[model samples]
Target chain A: MNRKEFIDQLKSSLSRLPQAEINEIIRDQEEYIQDAIQAGRSEENVIASLGDPKTIAASLNATTQIEKAVGATSLKQQAGHTFQAVFAMLALAPFNLIFVLGPFLGFAGLVFGGWVASSSIALSVVAVLIAFLFKFAFASAGIFSFLSMLLFLLGALGAATLALIAMYHISHFFLTSTIRYLRWNLKLAGITKN
Target chain B: MNSQFNKGVIEMCVLALVKQRDYYGYELVESISKRIEISEGTIYPILRRLTQEGYFETYLQESTEGPPRKYYRITTHGKKTAEDSVRDWKNFVTSVDSTIHSQEK
Candidate 1:
């Protein structure tokens, strides 16, 4: 293949990347080809020496996605980057879908489930506290009533605090795992930092 | 060499070369590929990653033959990394060599 066709193939394969990043990668390859040709090499020879465009694009996609995952600041952004990185990694080998997809889905479900459970527990505690306040306002002011109200308030606060701490811990675990998985994916794609 | 092994070595090679003098994309590719068989396309991503990691700085230099070229110069961080990597690689090779030779005997 000639230089243009080679670059066109590489560009099309890397369509998922941001336009600026895609352009930069393409420009590098184009310059390499230009230099090779200027140095008395044939277009075909230069393209051949560069190897397959699809493989090159796959490596580039893996590297870029891994970088994005590492650089993401927020949890939501990190999740997005991790998803993209995992998808890019799975793309490198179609058969990996069978082995990787099931475990990935399970892990995602567990994290989402933990979030839902923690949030619901916290919400329920608040709801109970609100309901108790309304009851205390309507009921007669007795010693037993006051004590019950104090007990309910303390219990609700304690439960809510515990739930929130659980949520924080769960989210932290998810973020750490996501980063580890991305690093594994990069290694699987042969983009190690060595 | 195995591609997996080459991937790591290539990063060190690039760092070591740039530590000696600044090199543009094409020039670096040519210099390394002359000694090691690698996909010339892979070097760009390595350069990009190294630059982002703050191990290298890049600038555009105008070329008389064509458009401006992006030249990469190693940072102090990159020089330190290269020295460490070279040391580790030598130690690894020595250990492996001794092990293999002993087994042959």
Candidate 2:
């Protein structure tokens, strides 16, 4: 391929990247081709030796996707970035599916379980409070005093709120650290530009 | 050999080379490719990343023969990183060498 063909293929492959990043990547290849020609190499020779444009674009995509995953603001956005990054990583190397996905799923399950437990803890208190009110309204009072029931509800609600807050922090920590861990793994896997 | 191993060493080599003197994209690629076989395209991503990480700074300088070229200069952070990478690489090589020799003996 000539310089234009090479750049065009790279640009198309990198369509997911922002225009500015795409431009920057194309410029590098342009300069490399220019320099090679200036140094007396034929365009075909330089392009051939540079390897596949799609492969180069894949490497660039994997690196930037991980950076985006790290810099993402919201949890939802973080999840999106993380998936894209991992997908890009997997595309670069199929062997990574076993090494990367297994640990990733295991940790993701733990985080999901923590969130589920916290929400259930918060919701179960509300359910109990509703049940107590229904029984009190229709039937004779039970062993516990009304004041004591109110106090118990307050205590349970408070504990559930605390659990929710703690899980928020724990899951947040898990996500950030997991992204960092993936970035390190990418470096070791040679998917990222170390 | 292992491509991953080459990449790790290439990062160290780029840091070390830029620490010694400023180099443009083509020049650095030429220097490294002289010693190690690699797809020439690979170096640009590594260069872009190292610059993004604040380890290298780039500037455009006009060339007499053609258009302006982008040159890379090592930063203070890059110098420190090069030193650490070199030290770590040396220690790793020494340990691996000793292991190999012991196994043979």
Q: Which ten residues in a row have the lowest lDDT in candidate 2 chain A?
A: A185-194
Tally clashes: model 1.
1
| lDDT tens readout by residue for model 1, B11-93 | 88888899999999888988988877777766776788788778999888888888678899999999999899899989999
Model 2: residues with Cα > 4 Å off, grouped in runs: A123-144, A191-194, B1-4, B94-105
For model 1, what is the error of residue A93's alpha carbon versus the real structure, in angstroms, after optimal superposition? Answer: 5.7
Candidate 1: deviation at residue B105, Å?
A: 2.6
Task: Please provide TM-scores, in order, for all candidate models, with all chains considered together.
Answer: 0.85, 0.83
Cα-based lDDT at residue A75, candidate 2? 78
lDDT of 2 by residue, B12-59 (tens): 888999999999988998998887778787777778768877899999
Clash totals, every prediction:
1, 0
Q: For model 2, what is the error of residue A115's alpha carbon versus the real structure, in angstroms, after optimal superposition?
A: 2.2
Kindly report the root-mean-square deviation of model 2 from the true structure over all alpha carbons.
3.6
Candidate 1: residue B84 lDDT (0-100): 95
**Residues A1-194, candidate 2, lDDT per residue (tens digit)?**
77789888999989998999998777767777889999999989889878778867776887887777777787777777777777776766668556868878798898889889889988999999988889888877755697699789989999999988887777678778767876666555542321
Q: Residue A85, candidate 2: how far off, in angstroms?
A: 1.8
Question: Which candidate wins on lDDT?
Answer: 2
